[model samples]
Target chain A: MRYTSFTSYDLILLAQGLGVSVALFLVTTLIGFLIGTIWAVMRFYRVPLLTPLITFLAELLKNSPVLVQLFLVFFGLPALLKINVTPVEAAVITLSGNTAAFIYVIAVAAIESIGRDQIESARVFGLSRWQILRHVVAPQAMAFAIGPLTGLLVNQLQVTSLISVIGVVDLTKIGNILNLRTLKPFIVWTVVGGLYYIAAKLIALGGARLERRLRAHTAWKGL
Target chain B: MILAPHVPFLLKGALLTAEACALALFGSLVIGLLVAALRTSSSPLLSRAAFIYVDLFRNIPFIVQLFFFFYGLPEIGIYIDAFTTGVLALSIAGGAFSSDVIRSGILAIDTGILEAAEVSGLSKPTIFRKIVMPIALRTSIRPLGSVFINLVLTSSILSTITLNELTGSAKIVASDTFRPFEVYAVLLIVYASLTYLISLAIGALHRRLNRDRMPDVA
Candidate 1:
């Protein structure tokens, strides 16, 4: 007889999948944030050739589908470079690059949202460029970027589902396995989608909380 | 060198992609219009229902939704080919996004103009169809363009469901030539340039449509 019925071990399998998805999401977001910010900083300094190059790379990443990127990395890279790349490694690289591209855009916009006058005044005040960035630009940009960053993070979490196609044993992959075994796509996908939905909501909630904290100083205060 | 022979095959896939995107775009615009209308309607229940749809579709990953429809539809006795299912899925997902854009466009309509329409004795549906939609769509052309661009990129995922569009056909070329790198790298550039051209066209269209209200609308 086919073991078509859902069992307790299935819960453990799902939890494992969820763990992988969440862990990968967190790690990639952190790496992407760092890489993307550095790219924005390069642009801010107007690094001669690098700024344009970074811009081109960001646009390429932004316009193309993540699936193609994943395929290029997972399937194409090993063959081209003659290197061994585990699925998880390929996923990490692809997702981090994708996330960084988006973050770079958001970071640049947040920086531009700061007025030129503020930077000029900081310069007039004998503030160093670094100080001007840290004291004047970073704080406000953080506040400005948090909203978009939150939206990006939620979207990135969903993008993680694409990695399942690359055989990452992510929540979607687990759902796929269960689906084929049980032949019940509705129950399998709903549960899987629901888990993703909850995770996205949590990211959104965290982002909102962070945004409120970042914007606290700007909130109106009683005289 | 190896990819040259496969150019026609890839072009065929591009043609399919173009056809699917065109049909899906039309389907999405209609669904978006209706959803946006419901979302902005006076009835709380209608608006709430629309809101839930937009929220659910927007939050959930598109692949999951695609899979749900791909697998679930057959179970419910709705037998459709992969192309049909793919287009239907894209339309629904694209509708959620386009609806959001159109709804905002609707929301941005000046109250004075709406009041004037009311005073002119136009019926609600007439005011909506004649006055509201044109202004909203014109104003929202740029955002709608982005939504459609996203739809194009998202179309690549249809390959997973076995539709063999541009990305899918590229997959075949990759395996056939054992040159996954060249095939996908070229595919990436093609997609990026294609989207870039689309955005350029959208910008021109936006400028031409809103020419009368130039500087303010853009």
Candidate 2:
């Protein structure tokens, strides 16, 4: 007899799926943030050959679909490099790289948003370039970048769902499994979508809170 | 190298992708305009309903929405083909995003224009048609272009539903020749170039439409 009835275990399965999704999202987001910030720094320093190359790579990543990028890493990389790539590994790599590309753009823009006069004043204070960046740019850029970064985070959270395609057992993959087993697409997918929606909203809320904190200094305080 | 044999097959897939995108683009624009209208309407209830629709659609991952339609619709006795399901899903999701763009466009309109139209005794529909839509759409052409380009990219996800769009056909060719790398890499470049060309065209269109406005941006 086909065991198609709804099991309480399914909730546990969903939680597990959500856990995997969030974990991967966090890990990849951290890696992407570091790599993206580094790329922005490279551009800031005007590293001749690497700067344009990084820009080009970011452009390609930004323009293409994440699904295509996933396929390239999951299927393409193993075949080309003769390496074993687990589904989770592929998801991490692809999502991180994709996230990095976007973060790089925001970082570059944030850095550029800083006026030249501020940097010149810091320079005249005899601060080195690195010191100037650390003292004069980092805080202001963080404030400027936080807003866009939140938007990107919300998007990247949704993007984490795509990892299901590469068999990462993310929320969508769990939804797929439940969908086929119970043949209840409406219930299964709705629950799955609801989970994602909540997660996205939470991220947005967190981002908004962070943005508020970052911008608190500039906020009006007049009586 | 082996891709030479599959070029014709991939082109066939590309054509299907184009067809689905075109249909979905039109569907999305219509839905987007309607939603934008509702969201901007004076009635708080209609505007709130539209807001909820946009928010719900925007927050959810699209794959979930696709599965919801693909499997849920059949259960409800709506037996549409995978292609129709894909297009419908794309339009619904794309509508949410496009509506946001159009709503922003509408909000950016000068209050003076609306007041002037009112003083000229223009009907609501007429005002929207002659004054609101033209100005809003003109200013928003660039953002709408990005939204449409996103539509094109998102259309690739339709492959998961057994619709043999570009990505779907490429998956077939990849397995057939055991050349996943070349197939997907080429697919990546094709998608990038496709969106790049789209943005370029959108840039030109934006300039053309907004020519009389800000010369700085144009």
Candidate 3:
């Protein structure tokens, strides 16, 4: 008996795929956010050598294809470094690095959005550079950056799907597998695409809510 | 174990990348222009349908759309080769993005200009072709260039559909030469350099086309 019918096991495969995707997204987002913020801070302090280098690196990362980045990490690293790397590990590293490069640019822009006069005034009031960063720049930059940061996170979530190319077995890969086995492109792809659509919408919704909350302090009050 | 001897083979892949990107660029320009017109048309139905097309394609992953065309088309008795399928997919996806850019370009036009064109009794199609398109194309050259660069990067996905484009051909050499590191590293540089050159060309084109209107553009 050839097992050609839609089986209950298919649902389990899909759930597992979604779980993989969510797990990878969360982990990469955290790592990428940290690295990107550090890069931005390196630029913020006007570190002579490192700032230019990070800018160039981030630009290179932003310009190239993410697929190429995946190849570099997943395929290139193992051969060059003489180490074993699981698909998941490669996905995490590649996605995080790519995300960080973009986030670094946004953070730099957000930091620069603050007026120099404000920093100068804060400095005159006996605020150290570190103190100004912590107490002054950080809060305002966060408020300004949150909107763009949310956009980046949503884009990064979509980007995680590219990891399926390297055999991570995310939702896209699961869709591919089910498509091949069931020979049901419409049903399999529709359900798969529908799942992705809903997830993307949820991310957008969450970002909007976060943006509203973050900007609540600046909201206009009744006279 | 080394790839020095295989430079010519890899160059062939690069040539394929160049060819596919050129063709897809032209294809996308056509789709983009049509969709942009539809989007900015007086007909609500046409505009709404165009908007939906753009939105749906933009939101979905390109790979899914690629597979849909690559696999689903054959099932429905439309037989096109992998190269054609890849080009079609890239054109469609690029069309969505380019249309967005071009639509805004059209919207940014001054109504007084359109009114003057109308006062001259120019036909709608002619006005669209002669005035609106020329202006929109000039203004949107930069965004469209980025869209085309994206199309080039996206052309990599076509490798999975069995088209031996740049990345596809690189995969073969990677396995044959057993130098995945150098191959992909080189491929990444190739793509980055390709896009950089494209953006530079776009900058020049933007300057040249808007020379008469440089004050505003600058």
Give all candidates' CA lDDT scores. Answer: 0.95, 0.94, 0.87
lDDT of 1 at A220: 83
- The TM-scores, chain A only, for the candidates as listed are 0.98, 0.98, 0.97
Ranking of models by TM-score: 2, 1, 3
Q: Per-residue lDDT tens digits of candidate 2, residues B39-123?
A: 9999999999999999999999988899999999989888999999999999999999999999999999999999999999999
Fill in the DockQ of model 3: 0.64
What tens-digit string does per-residue lDDT give for candidate 1 at A67-107? 99999999999999999999999999999999999999999
Q: 1 or 3: which has the higher DockQ?
A: 1
Looking at candidate 2 chain A, the ten consecutive residues that score lowest on lDDT are: A1-10
**Model 3, A1-223: lDDT tens per residue?**
4566689999999999888988899999999999999999988889999999999889888888888889888889999999998999999999989989989988988899999999999999999989999999998998899888876776677778788999999998998998888887877877776676677778878888888887888999768
Model 2, global lDDT = 0.94
Error of 2 at B94 (Å): 0.6
Candidate 3 runs further than 4 Å off: A219-223
Worst 10 residues of 2 chain B by lDDT: B129-138
lDDT of 3 by residue, B155-184 (tens): 888888887778888889888878899999
Backbone clash pairs for candidate 2 read none
Residue pairs with backbone overlap in model 3: none
Candidate 1 global lDDT: 0.95
Q: Give candidate 1 misplaced runs (Cα > 4 Å).
A: B216-218
